[model samples]
Target: MAERSEEVKLLGMWASPFSRRVEIALTLKGVPYEFSEQDIANKSPLLLQSNPVHKKIPVLLHSGKPISESLVILEYIDDTWQNNPILPQDPYDRATARFWGRFVDEQIYVTAMKVVGKVGEEKDAAVEATRDLLKLLEKELVGKKFLGGERLGFVDIVATLVAFWLMRTEEVVGVKVVPVEMFPEIHRWVKNLLDVDVIKKCIPPEDEHLNYIRARMDRLKLKSV
Candidate 1:
């Protein structure tokens, strides 16, 4: 793979699933970039300048230009790299991919958050909602190996929250959102996503990631107390 001449920099936090999305995409396209580990709490000047509107990490700086937001950054990466193509060439297929990517953001992740640290009737209701949301995905995935069909695409990258983060959150909170028998399609999709080489490189070691979540949740609990 020929490296891009322009310097590429990624402003990201390791714990952020969004940042992980950018990392996976760059690795898949074999794009070389400098990773600037940002202290979001402190809000680095460069990070602020790059993403003034969102003031968020996972900003991709290609040459002197800045692209913010994980989803928007993802589109920019695909357009710029033009290799290993994250979205299918077919117009309808590309549109389908975009729709699902938004669904993951708007529906899946938002619904799953309701289950985190929630209890009693609220937790139960949230769990049910999450189940319903996942069922839609399970149906879509019935005849396909991946959400992206043959390759890891935009939908697969965006669904990292479902594939990895949600499972970790469930372990920490002891609320099981996905069970193998209940969500076989999601389970299979996750297994296939984990098997992807670029994904493996981007995901933090299981022990490290789990420990981080455990510590973060403990902090949250203390705050509530």
Candidate 2:
């Protein structure tokens, strides 16, 4: 692999939001890179070796060096490419962007996962927690067209799934995780972002994405029973 040092590759999964994030950022920046679709369940040796810590997809292999974690990869892409400028330029603004980036990935993303795969009191608590955290994001998007302003940036890219994926997840599970009536601002932001031709192209087809979610939820429900 030594000769492949200069080559850029992304190990990803079609259904993975993390993978989707890196793909969108790369496309937006006009960076050329090869993509290797990973079978997440079967796992790949390269995926394991690249991300030994978490053993996850969306690992960026740049110049033979591996970068793990989707949020971190997004920043690395921004810094390395430097053309499109994913983060805000001002010092305070950049820090604020990163701050919100972390908040979405940590607080909101984690809680959103809990909305699925649980039942009764557990599901209720998860729904409440996820909704409460989303309210914070709703407040964050109160004034901005995108999380980072007029353009999609770190926060917006990292939050790709928090809105889109959750929307589909809520539908498949028949839950109210992202009630449009309650979080108008966030939903509006979602529509704005997805409406973009570039980003829209990166997303999986609606029927395919929904079917994937529905099948996964069905499997989870069966296991629970």
Candidate 3:
């Protein structure tokens, strides 16, 4: 029998897509962990102690050793566990998957946040940038069921995180970067991704997420006024 340990801990925030990414990865791997919800605004002592540098949520602690960064944590989870493989076996395919994963971080997530956080012309520009990024993703998904072709892989995980945040931002900002008619491929991808049992259950309640973003946007609006 394999040695069973009970030392895995995940520090996360409810509204954070990064946190969701880590949670999904762990759940997919069937790794048992204790989840500690962190108040990012208040900053928990345990979170600060575990991730002294970034002091960010979504920190994974295995046997008391903490690891920060969602992508790095995903890689860690995939590498440490052998039962459910998240990455591809072929080196070239793995690199492609990693490229798309990084692309989601750099393009979709970065642009979507900027779009939601800005006002007037800046906000319009950000929306345009996000639309362009989504168009690119649409092209990428032309003939694929998932980013890894058939199965949900690393790139799919990253892309799903982007979609989750983007959807919330759209509700809060009262703008649609991903117009369903314009980007049929991405719309299809979003529907497919959300249909997955784990993802459907793992996503934060939609109304709750929307309310959270709306509150933040209202605060920003008040600050500007």
Candidate 4:
């Protein structure tokens, strides 16, 4: 009910990279917020009401109004808080950033869901598909420190899944999709991205992600059997 611009409340899950995006954005911009961790399995009333359509986590409640979806929330944060700009100053560059950000979220992250907890041929195919996508991203990262070049921005935020989540998931599933030697640029970009204090703080501990993915992989293995 508070109307203060800084009264940002994020309803998120600790293991979700999407939730991490909002947290990192807020932290990078120096905007303080109260985080309410949600249990997705049980589904909280607040999360349902805030995002009734999808019932998803990472909902941003700003001054009583809720904004759903991680990418949209990132844009809103950048627009509302002008100090730490996430998008580019030039219109064309901003459009380019948005394009790759959306590509990473919709294409890369969505495809990754199929690879995790999967087995046999399906898992192999998924990994190959996901790798193809990552190769394109690696080309984009060539000759750049981050997606936006020199600093982190929209594309970098969306690609955070690869920087943090992918490695942990690979360990849990006992697979190697994004091999550092193969995707050297992405590997380097990931290290550079995580070096930032905000990103380092917001990224869930590797063990936490490992446990979560291990549980999911176990369930998938049982189902396959």
Looking at model 2, which ten-residue stretch has the lowest summed lDDT? 1-10
Task: Please provide, for model 3 over 1-225, each residue's C-alpha lDDT reduced to its tens digit, 9 standing for 90 to 100.
Answer: 022226788999888888888888878877788889999889999899988898888899998898998889988888887666888989998888888888889877877777755779999999898888878888999988877678778888877766787866776788888888888888788888877887886788988988898888788778777
Per-residue lDDT over 1-225 for candidate 1, one digit per residue giving the tens place of the 0 to 100 score = 344624899999998899999999999988989999999779999999989998998899888789898999999999988988998889999999999999988998899887766679998999999989999999989888888887788898988878878877888888788888899989988889878899988987888899988887777668767
Question: How many clashes (backbone N, Cα, C below 3 Å) per candidate?
Answer: 0, 0, 0, 0
Tens digit of per-residue lDDT, candidate 4, span 1-225: 124556889999998999999998988888879999999889999999999999998899998899999999999999888887999999999989889988988899889889866779999999999999999999998999999889888889888988888867888777889998889998899889768998899999887778887887788778768
lDDT of 3 at 59: 94
**Weakest 10 consecutive residues of candidate 4 by summed lDDT:** 1-10
Full-model lDDT for every candidate = 0.87, 0.86, 0.82, 0.88
Model 1 / residue 194 / CA error / Å = 2.1
Regions of candidate 1 where Cα sits further than 4 Å from its true position: 1-6, 223-225
- Expressed as tens digits, the lDDT of each residue in 103-189 for candidate 2 is 888888788788778879998999999899889889989888998888888888888878678877888767888888999999999
TM-scores, all models, native as reference:
0.94, 0.93, 0.93, 0.94
* Model 4 quality (TM-score): 0.94
RMSD of candidate 1 to the truth, in angstroms, is: 1.6
- Best-to-worst lDDT order: 4, 1, 2, 3
Pairs in steric clash, model 2:
none
